[model samples]
Target: MTSYAFTFPGQGSQAVGMGKDLAAAYPEARAVFQEVDEALGQRLSAIMFEGPEDILRLTENAQPALMAVSLAIVRVLEARGLRVSGHAAYVAGHSLGEYSALAAAGAFTIADTARLLKTRGQAMQKAVPVGHGAMAALLGLDLAVASEVADAASQGEVCAVANDNAPGQVVVSGTVAAVERAVELAKAKGAKRALLLPVSAPFHCALMQPAADAMAQALAEIEMRAPLLPLVANVLAAPVSDPAEIRRLLVEQVTGVVRWTESVRWLTGPGGVTNLAELGTGKVLTGLAKRIDPQAIATAVSTPADIDAFVAQLGL
Candidate 1:
């Protein structure tokens, strides 16, 4: 039996026709999409399956679309008799992927997760005015050095680390001028590339305080339960199972750094996660997991064929 950690991708992973095939092939998968559409009270399914690209790419649309696809994949796996509660030991996600992990782990229903993400996306976008904030990736720099660069480049603006994706990859987000300054400082500090990311809003920074406040109120209204399995939280990069702590972390995550590199390391090292199954649109997280821990078996199951292969491997 494989002891795996199931993870879902954040933004930048969604694509047109992402979960359409699975919906076509499996009723279980179709039901997941239907549930999400009903939850959001709209035809987001149409936007996801046959997208205008621009509409689907909107932060509000993209968050729930990605979660729906991820939950669909999980439903397919469950239909195949591959129970996550039985085989998986831990669950973690990258950024917004944390919501997917929570949905998968039974902390919330797929409908609730979709609704929450929709609110989260809209809040994040509305928090900062366009052209006022931005995010940039600092390649070839570790977290400590990247933090220093961001701090030095603040220039009385709100520049801070947003994501520590991999050992050498860090993303900074804040006021546009501060992020640009951070880019220059990172380049001067021997960063291989300090490129601005094409993101709609400055996420995961103090500038997102409005979004955090929005989420705090929204989450307080939602029902939360302790997960059956541990979740490696984004802000802490550590396993947490308490419902209240998870809620607090979710609010913090809106403005805290995503410690992804540390989260992956925890899964493979002290967390005892041996296999990592990525349940989402793209294989980006799988690729990152490979680079993060080569010994960990990473699998991507977006399509029906991929799920079939996974079931066969599990002898289910």
Candidate 2:
């Protein structure tokens, strides 16, 4: 028996027409899109399938859209007899993808997950004014060196490490000037490339505290159940199953470092997860998994063909 973990992609994985083919081929996939639209009381599916890139790229739309596609893929997989809880040892996701992971694991209803993400995206967007904050990726620098560079760049500002994505890849988030300073400092400190990201806001920093508070209130109102499988939370970089603990971590994750590199290590390390199935639109996480641990097998399932191939591999 193959021991695998299911992973989901986050924001940057979205693209126009992502799930259209899957929806065209599977009623289960179509229903996931329909439920998200109804929950949000708008045609998110249309926006996803027919994109006015500007509107669809809005944080509010992109967050739930990504989740919907992920859940759609999960529904199709389940319909094909590849239930995650039965087949995978653990489930994890990047940033907003964590919500997708929870929905796939039966911790929350599809409708609830959609609503939460909509609120989360809007709140996060509203947290910091545009042009006031920023995020940048420092390539060829380890997390410790990245942290040192961020600290040096802070200069009494809010520069902080946002993501430890993979080996020698760390992202920093802060005030625009501080992030720019960090970029130069990282380059000076021997970073191969330090470039500002095209993101709208500086996420996962003190600047996002307001968004974290909003998520606290929003998450408090939702009813959460223990996940069917353990979740490797981004903030903790460890497995967590308690509903209340998960709720708290979800809030903390707003302003906390997304320990993607550490989380992947924890999954493939002592967790003994040898295979990673990325159940989302893009192959972002699949690529990251290979870079994180070359020994682990990674695959992505998105379109109908990908789903069929994955199910065949499982002999289902």
Candidate 3:
């Protein structure tokens, strides 16, 4: 008798051997991994189970790898009699995690999502050359102040807010110079910490326009269906069910700020979701869920044990 919103982790949640255990424990999980491997025509599961660390961390691999783990967990949960249609109230994901959420809700198949994420990762990386772009985290600064700081620091470059993760954690992405300037301005504006992230591309900014264009073409060819459950889209921080709208939003998300704080607020506030089950590679979103809303019961279902326990708790 529990109603919860299912959330998926984004890029930074990846790790070595992310889905290895679940693959060993469940056939459905294993099948999901195999399908992704076939779709990408690469041994991505090997990288996920046994990584060279750096390769798996590549944006191209990381996007689908994270989604694969999430989809694997979703398949296992389905096998356990947990239907997203009737069991979960809504679904949301962080950045690339949105694809995983859509796949779980049947908006896209696992194979198609894998291919799209692979394309997305490659497009994003190709959009910006190495050392030309950067992203920085500005702690202890609200979105309004962060926006002001980014604008002031832009120096006529493409600097802008990329993610509003929480109340005071804002991330800015842009050319290296602009992001560096934003860091300095944020620190001077009384931020507790402002530091650059070790990311290859300045994602979710105007500079990613090329990637957005690529995704528009890529998404246009793919077949999208309405989700079984509504999705709290990143760009809107609101529920969307139309396939066409979701397609457009997915393209816009490439350069749009991820309104995660607002999305979580909608879930716990007006959406009335009490429990948050984060199904993915790491507990990154789980931690953020509590930070975003203390009263929400956030659980990470990343392992076979976690899935077993969660399914039982739900009376499945």
Candidate 4:
């Protein structure tokens, strides 16, 4: 009774020439880029294919660009006679990648997903002024210890755990000084590594409440359908299939901790998911899956060769 789940990557995974090879080989993949460009009313494909890294790394551009690359891989897979509904029992994503997962599950059109992610990235960036907020990664510390470090560092400021990524990897987000304090405290508390991330804004923290409010309004106007497979929500770390509930959680996720560690455990645990397929540009999620559960089968399917190998292995 082995099962599989499709996973999508978030912002930091994007690169300048992410889906170019895939699009060159598959018309379906090229169409995904075309649709995303049309939806955004701009030539995002050009930026993605040939970029000044700085521009592509912009929050607003990176979010939808990553989603488009993910969906392009999904489309290529479908064109290759491998269907998600037949292979995956669940879908999950990190941060903005949630929108990509929803779209892959047929909950939203690619066009709408592109627009929504653009709006989301902009809102998140505007939520806090530059240099006023920050994020940091704490390695060799679990959620509880990380929370303690964040709490001890807060000191009337807003330092909170943003992502529980793996066994001993956590990210904290908050005001710049508070986050920097957390980094110092994490090292003092025996964390192997604690470093501030170079990010445009503090995400998945109370500082993002304004972005959450903005998402509420944007999501309310979009038509959502129940996903083909249940989603492992970032906030809940559990299966959620209800469309209305999905919408609510999307808003909550803006300022909530991404319980990726718990979500991966649930998938490899009682969910009985044996295989985790990362359908995007980078192998970041694949690498994280191995860190989370070395026994779990993790695969990356970005290029045509990867897809071919996967299809052959699955006998699809």
Top candidate by lDDT:
3
Per-candidate TM-score against the hidden true structure: 0.98, 0.99, 0.99, 0.99
lDDT of 4: 0.94
- Stretches > 4 Å off in candidate 1: none
lDDT of 3 by residue, 1-316 (tens): 4579999999888889889999999999899999999999999999999998899999999999999999999999898898998889999999999999999999999999999999999999999999999999999999999999999998889999999998899999999999999999999999999999988899999999999999999999998889999999999999999999999999999999999999999999989999999999989889888999999999999998899899888999
Clashes of each: 0, 0, 0, 0
C-alpha lDDT values of all predictions:
0.92, 0.93, 0.95, 0.94
Score residue 249 of candidate 3 by CA lDDT. Answer: 97
- Residue-wise C-alpha lDDT for candidate 2, range 98-138, written one tens digit per residue: 99999999999999999999999999999999999999999
For model 1, what is the alpha-carbon lDDT of residue 116?
96
**Model 3 ranges off by over 4 Å:** none
The regions of model 2 sitting more than 4 angstroms off are: none
Off by over 4 Å in 4: none
lDDT of model number 2:
0.93
Clashing pairs in 1: none
Assess candidate 3 and give its lDDT.
0.95
Residue 239 of model 4 has an lDDT of 95
lDDT of 1 by residue, 167-214 (tens): 788999999999999999999999999999989999999999999999
